[model samples]
Target: QFVLPDANLGVIAFIRLAGIKADQLLKNCPKEYWVPGLTYMSEWSHQWLDYVTRTSGRLTKSVRFCDLGDFKMSMLEREVTRRDGEAMGVMEDCYPQLLQTVFLCNASSWIQVPWRLLRPIMPKRVTSKFEIISPETNVHERKMLLQYIDEENLPTRFGGKNAVWPVHFPLPEN
Candidate 1:
């Protein structure tokens, strides 16, 4: 079976079942910057139906924008496609497996540098207790900072088990 991200996988499965040859070409495709790590989330949910449809040659699906009091989906959508004219797709079931494989094959040295270097840059005030800050808030800035460090620090490889960098954070005193 072909393992793919949820949005693409679902579309491919549907197309194949309908007797169509579908190729999900993502080469040089635009990245969805607004929704960070969305490809790591589940793909079979209804919320991502429009994204799946748009990317899989099915653009007729209705697209609605919702506001969550503080943020609007339209704004996020615009930001996603702002860089490369591409939007984010929903996550698939195989994403975790893909990450596991990626983690195993990449070089440990490449993974360790970012984690080690970023420790000093992370806000010292960001304790574990106040972790629910919005992406629009200062807390969100820290989250992005950490995510950027991790992504840049992770190693990319084809085939081999590699050790991941250790994340060291001081525990809160009781």
Candidate 2:
């Protein structure tokens, strides 16, 4: 459910595939498929920037790269550190300025290992950006998401009153 919750607050939800072989997730996504999607993001971000200019609105933009299937760290690392890693370089290089907040969801602490590995390799500008996912927050996750998004727009897994999840992709093969 990638949405600009309000015109004033351009919030988007981009769900990354988790708990899968890294190659299938990004490394092996065909160039034809990969290139266009990257192009779309570049275009869409420019649109968002233009909207900001016209509206004179200040917003906190966020990207949620969810670990929906509870991916393990080993799988997570390949997507970020591997040289042929598709989205990794693009995200770190291209997407930084457009976003103010980023978070990872449903992933475990194994994130630390890969994060540490990638941290040294990334430039200061990239390294400064942080993705926070806190399950231990005082408020529940469902309530937290609902605070910004109306219940009707949220995925059911987030305790949304409307809309089932898997809105984009179908069930993964075991």
Candidate 3:
């Protein structure tokens, strides 16, 4: 998922799904919920998907194959603690919409597979006009950002050298 703030900067979310397996990707979405498994996407990210899907621009899925065979997906599940009554799980199947949204995103996608993930069964990658390079470390990531992001807007963490830091906010207790 990404955030295109007025198209000047593209914020691509490159989260590491360390111990998660293919089927366990949305393990905490809860089958009983009205939103089905897609709840794991969060309302905010779904809005971003709506925007990017309509525009068909600046989306990438760079995957890496890591050795995580011993990791337990069950261990990652969060316990339910409710302050309000029955607000979380209201069952309805939302898989169709989720599938369609994913398909639309894939239509305008640039997928990158690290060399370790290259397999004979994998599909051939199509060439993209837009350059979507995934740098290994923060140093390399900063260099890649230099091409698309201006020095003023880029974060210091990514080697922007900007003096100011982004505001930190605590997560909502809800």
Candidate 4:
């Protein structure tokens, strides 16, 4: 059986369709490590052939930031090189600032939602607020927020959009 911790809720729904016991699998993992938002899994029967050929490993801390900078740079370099040398020169002039602005905007939005949400969850802890002081809220605020979240070592990528927001849900009374 393939186990995923704190995986997306969808996996549970998926297991139900195949008459597999999801609750038992979930019970095997510790409560704190089970990130309900991040976990995802598929039944062994659905793709048995692929499963037989593949190797699986435990989800350790090291698995989390998989050389993202190198991967991104490689992709960018490949795409640029695919174009003619003259085109690459033009792109070099036009891309860096524009790309930086886009990344900043996405990061800013990520930081803002958590700031508003986390206050109710962890009231006593320090909270980072995203200020929209500049006309370039999409650019400047986002860049600032990305830097702040990175320093805190929070998970940032949520399906290409940074999910820097912290989620807190109250536990059920025993």
Candidate 5:
């Protein structure tokens, strides 16, 4: 995920699905790996909470932008869903409302399948923050994204002017 340069409106963590390799992910990442991962995220979330509280008070929260372009059903493997559910559960238990919104863009109807499965496992507060958008096809969705995120903070590919975090950039080294 790439953090947008503009922080006037809070952090905007961007993620794109096009670069993911389903087979490689499943082969490489085992379910046992996520527990420690969630722990690390919890630590990070606490730091983020402290930072947001110090800067803009407790009400401010970070948002996520998930670009679903080129998303495939193969990416929704059972292991993936299970890990995601665990992660969301951890977030709810520890961070609570740390994430203000999750903008899902360029999504197709196929999203319903995973949403249906995952929604049942997620709490209302967590699920409520999600905003499924189709900026590629629907004008209303695009407007909604722009309403939440300003054009200058968004990448040009996502209808913004930020060239530093382009959609096609090479993945950063971990």
Candidate 6:
């Protein structure tokens, strides 16, 4: 995932996620490294928060675009889910209310199973912010996402003109 260079409406950050084989990539790591891995993610989250605060303002928040275009069932293994839960917990602990919305794009019907199980467990504050977009409603959801994020800030893959990932730019100052 990477943040867009420009903030949405000058205050909201646009974070884009590219679908990747995350489970395969991390499943081989030993359990001993998990803590350090979460720490690294925390540090990265701080950098992003700092960037938004500096570029926009202290009140700036984020909107995440989770593109599951290449997602597979194997990616939802127990280990991956556990790691993800830990990382999310850390983020919430470190920066509450930093996320304004989460757009789950290109989601298949398989997602409903997990969403059903997860939704009841998640706080209303968190669950209410999520917006899932399936293949059937891609066009409509794209319009919805555009309502919050300007077309210029969105990446080409998400119906915007920005083709480059923000990683190619500079990292936020520590």
The candidate scoring highest on lDDT is 5
> Number of clashes in every candidate structure?
1, 0, 1, 8, 0, 0
What's the candidate order when arranged by decreasing TM-score?
5, 6, 2, 3, 1, 4
TM-score of each: 0.19, 0.58, 0.31, 0.17, 0.72, 0.67
Clashing pairs in 6: none
The segments of candidate 3 whose C-alpha lies over 4 angstroms from its true place after superposition are 1-11, 14-29, 34-43, 49-114, 117-121, 125-142, 145-174
Off by over 4 Å in 6: 7-19, 54-58, 112-123, 134-140, 147-149, 163-174
**CA-lDDT, candidates in order:** 0.27, 0.53, 0.34, 0.27, 0.67, 0.62
- Model 4, span 131-166: residue lDDT tens: 222212234433443332332232333222424333
The positional error of residue 142 in candidate 2, measured at the CA in angstroms, is 6.7
Q: Which stretches of candidate 1 lie over 4 Å from their true place?
A: 1-25, 28-41, 45-106, 123-174
TM-score of 6: 0.67
lDDT of 3 by residue, 1-174 (tens): 233322322223322233344444335445466243335533444454445555666542221112222334443434322311122232113222321111101111123344224434445332221233333233554465555445554444344544443312232222
Tell me the lDDT of model 1 at 168: 24
Q: What digit string (tens of lDDT, one per residue) describes model 5 on residues 103-131?
A: 88777788966786898799998688897
Residue 59, model 5, lDDT? 64
List runs of model 2 lying over 4 Å from the truth.
19-22, 25-28, 59-62, 77-96, 112-128, 135-152, 156-163, 167-174
Per-residue lDDT of model 1, residues 1-174, tens digit only: 111123342211101111111122223333443234333332333334445545677532211111122222223333324432222323223332111111111113433455457646777542221222222233433343233123232111111122332222222221
- Candidate 1: worst-modelled 10 consecutive residues by lDDT: 98-107
Worst 10 residues of 6 by lDDT: 8-17
TM-score winner among the candidates?
Answer: 5
Model 6 whole-model lDDT (C-alpha atoms): 0.62
Question: Mind giving the per-residue lDDT tens digits that candidate 6 earns over 57-106?
Answer: 65555666777666667656677668768777877787787777777777
What lDDT tens digits, residue by residue, belong to model 2 across residues 31-96? 567655655655565466557546764544454435344565455454334433554466547655
